[model samples]
Target: MSSNLPKNFPGRPASAPTPSEVPAPAPSAALPKNFTPEMARAAAALQAGAATAAGQAPSSGAAAAEQPAAQARGQAAMPGGPEVTRGEIADHFAQRIVRMVDAHRGDSSRPRLYAIEFPFTDFEFDVAYALAGRLGATLSASDAAVDDDEPARPLVMLDRVLNNPQQFERIVRHINHGQDVQLVCTRAWQLPQSVADLVDATLTIPRFDAPRFAAACVDFYELGAPPALGADADWVPNVVPRDFLLNSQVARSDIVSAVRQSVERRLRRYATDDALDLADLAGMDEAHDWARALIDEVALARSGAISWDDVGGRVILLGARGVGKTTLARAIARAAHLRYVEASASDWAPPQNEPQLGWMRMNAAFQEAMAAAPALFFVDDVDAFSIAPWAGMLPAFLEQLKGLSADDRVVLIAGAQSAEHVRFELHRRGALETTLTMPAPNSQALAKMYSVLLRGSGSTLAQADLEHIGLLSLGMTGHEVELIVRRALRRARKDGGRDVSKEDLAQAIIEQRVGPESQDRRRLMAADELRNTAYHEAGHAILELMRTRGARLRYASIIPRENGSLGFVLPGVDESRNSVTRNDIVEMVRVALAGRAAEEVFSGPEGTTSGCSNDLQQATAYLRYLMTRSGFHGLLSLDRSFEDSPELRERAESMLQAEYAHVLGLLQRHRPLLDSVAKLLIERQEVSGDELTRVVDAYRSSHPLV
Candidate 1:
């Protein structure tokens, strides 16, 4: 057989094929006149396989033609020895071309079969557009896949479009039929079939987290290059390497600014690492302190003053959603001068990949982070990663994290949306010796923050105005406060880019109560549904004011809104506030049951709807805490066997029922107040605490609570 392959190609036939050993093509050969070097090697492999099956021996002329190449790769991992049989040659060719396709193919739509397993769907673009973005090709998409003029780029929307014959055929033709046609799948979606039928070869991308996310953005912008590159120092974000790919398109400053707006837009959920600028950060003193400690530890490790394990291997940042855990972790990394590499739960368990491979992938990711030592290793949404009874992964990941933390040069931080079940797993084995809870800023801090954030938008607010806004937003996370700023900016842009008016600030607060964005597009509630919602929220408002001193009631809304709420009475909790007494717990249960009790009293049981499910759930959860968290339940000794669970349930149910009864009686006595508040809610669609109080006061003057 003749050959043309890379000189370093592994597994050359392990012998010098002497002049007497070469074999020739058969006399009836149908070889083409022109073929690629790769095709020539393939044809040679096939010829050798066929000849070996037929028991043919090599001739002198063929041996002479291929001897040097054979002897060159003689020691490669081929099974057989120096005689160099036809089967051996075919195997060698297979090892070279088939086994190692990925390393050589970078962004080339090569002739191949492969799959890509994404960890999560950050952005699920259309197949045509996604393919165009990846391949640097243009494609015009139509409603029907078959109707598209271009068939050269055969993309697949395997998630939903696979059932469509045209799309399925396109996937098949892209993989099994042609060379130079690349196949692309849009974001993370469930796989329709088992791994075998669907995937040929899966492409695994490097795990991306906030640090790498920041680094990539920095690298792409060339924001700060080495002094040799002559870029301004301020242009560079404080990010270092694990540099993957940089686009270098010289994006317009406004375009880059627009990309940045996405960061602020997402601040309402979690802090984007890129968006954690020190100037924008406010009210996370505890988390920032943790960041400083981690930075100091990293510096200590570098100076040989402490081992990596001694760097306090893990920090568990506990907070509600939209809190600054992710942002704080990123900020710590940037301040500590470490690269950030984030691996998520989805990264550990991707769809379609085998369970074994998933573990291996996760383990490999940790190893990679260690290689990028002096890096911040973060695990985000850890609770979501393992919400089941036993995640089957906790032990291994826990150990891996602990091991990495001890490395003396790497830092590990885990962000939990809530630190409930996993807290023990994190703290028990000393896996995470340190725990930091990132609560919301206090009213005073929030007032100060509001002043700063509002002023950043070129708006001014009086001390009284800031304090009022802060009181109204007392329970909000830092990200939520930032979102209010983002909203004010949006308003400022609308109002000819001037300053944020007081009305703009008021509207932003209203948006926080009812929306993450505009809610005008949602369907309006029917008149009856609107009435039920108004009265339900009014019940919560009245109970919150009369019982908790109007401190808990932030704003009551009857409008359908974000997070699947039909109506809601949001309560404010001090950011620095921790520990609720048993009475506080009981009062909270009553407040939660107020909406349902109101429905039963005024509209009857049939009038109640599924809208009260969340309220019922909250009340049930607090009651469960009373039974289980012995410290709160006043139990001197506890037994978690839960053997008396039935009795516990009965007691909890009875207590909840009594609270419901109590709420019912209160609503009955304040029927006039309830009617007055509900009427105002229906008129205005929202009622702040002061308005609710004023209405209640007016009603009491007309009909006293006594």
Candidate 2:
């Protein structure tokens, strides 16, 4: 081996060889005069291998030299290697010389020579121009000389004609031949296969600084740096230290184990931690008070510096739409000083690279925290994360979480609309450790929510208005309450006052209606519809009063409202345990037909309203149930088939026909009640139960029972 190579040469010996030790070239040698002894040795080995493969013994040194010479000449005549067109040769040689200069001068210095192929393609020109500009070098067309006087700088070939592979191989061969070349093949698509094979390195536009490039390199190579580095002016062997590599692998394994531990610890923590107090998020005083107590219990347990034990377990907050699940989850994270990582179900993707890398990242985040205390990984919209495409990945994620050791001290809090949905997905996988259901705001909470919203807007609302809003928003969530309040506030502001009136709140409530109310309202005209609804309800009340004279009429309104009703009448009655009677069924039928009768009498025969659709359906079903299921029909001789029997059916039909006629007659006779109720509805747009009762009592006193 050569001993006294340049210091820049890597893996070379420091000392020169003695003269006697240096072997002279053999007489049989036929290699290029400039070929190094090492190159000659490599060539000799190749020749020997060729000879053995041909079933012949190793050739003599002289014979081997002759054989390679003949082979090279034969290869030169073959059309296999890179084709060297006149234009390609110039471009290749030029690029070779430029690379030689760049290699020798270092990155900071510009190469002395630059040769560019003429009429460059867009890709070629862009690359060449960028390189020349970067090095502060000049670009010259093919056939152009660098200088007539001094030695020209190496030419850089920007071959725009050769295909990708041809250009790539040509560049590689020139470098192997010891030519200083840097080829830029702009016509890469022309020789895709060849380019794909020989291009060892690629330089994308926008060269970055060392730090970015280093990070990018690490990511691309999927490898880490050595634990230590040695100071040197020249390139060193730079093999990764065996100890460091081994330590990193151990550390990675430890991290994976720690992550598994943390998940388990989190589940246990949430189980014991006090339930989340969501009063502030709820924004209702009563709810706040109630939630505060629960929050305080957790706070007490977590008091005086949080430790692994203080950390809560994984909590899945489940609720309907517009509930405060997300809000509560965030609040918990903020209060507990836990790092929240929010991920939607949709955000979960199939795991790539390794099955455990995602878990590893998550684990790494909390591994350090375990030594100090515990942290929370709040995953939001967890249901979305469990979609079918991500099912395979989800099990691994959940399994990794389940496998987490207790020592890791991390909590997992998930938020979803339905705990059942998540439970269904994870129950089999055993993902859910604890499920907390968030109920909609209660009446008191609803009132308090309205008050809070009003107070924030510097407005004063009467207790009556608050009560009304509360009653209307009974089944609504905290978010719905907030939305209702916000809408009311906006109305108040637009009306040029901070005070929200009862009418304003009611209007806001109507405007914010969802579901059926949000549908088109053009099914029936308003006035005719209101009148019909009032008459129909009046008929029912009047008939009920006639059948059960003691039954008191509480209230009736013909106001067009959401949820597909034109009017409604709630009859006042004493709370009792009494079941239904035949008389009650007949009276109910009369009340149901009151609106249609009133329409027929007041709005004429042509007057009809779509409002009766729901009423008709309900009344028919009730009558049918009573006659058949309740055994109220007189046809005792009939079995279940009585409903299909002509005689039994005829009897039920006659009874219903009479009841319908009676209902219409009652509505027609109590025209005074109809007029009064309609007038009130038009004026108030909404009549309370008390108001309806008072009106009904007045009408009954004036006109007597039908």
Index of the highest-TM-score prediction: 1
TM-scores for all candidates: the values are 0.52, 0.46
For 352-467, candidate 2 gives per-residue lDDT tens digits of 54433343333333332332233455566667644565554465456545644444445666777865457365644346666677777665667776776666566667777686
Which lDDT values do the candidates have, in the order given?
A: 0.56, 0.48
Distance from true location, Cα of 300 in model 1, Å:
5.7
Candidate 1's TM-score? 0.52
Which residue ranges in model 1 land beyond 4 Å of their true spot?
Answer: 1-47, 50-287, 297-322, 349-356, 363-374, 380-409, 414-433, 440-456, 462-470, 474-476, 479-488, 491-533, 548-552, 562-566, 574-672, 697-704
Please report how far candidate 2 places residue 148 from its true position, in Å. 53
Residue 613 shift from truth in candidate 2, angstroms: 2.5
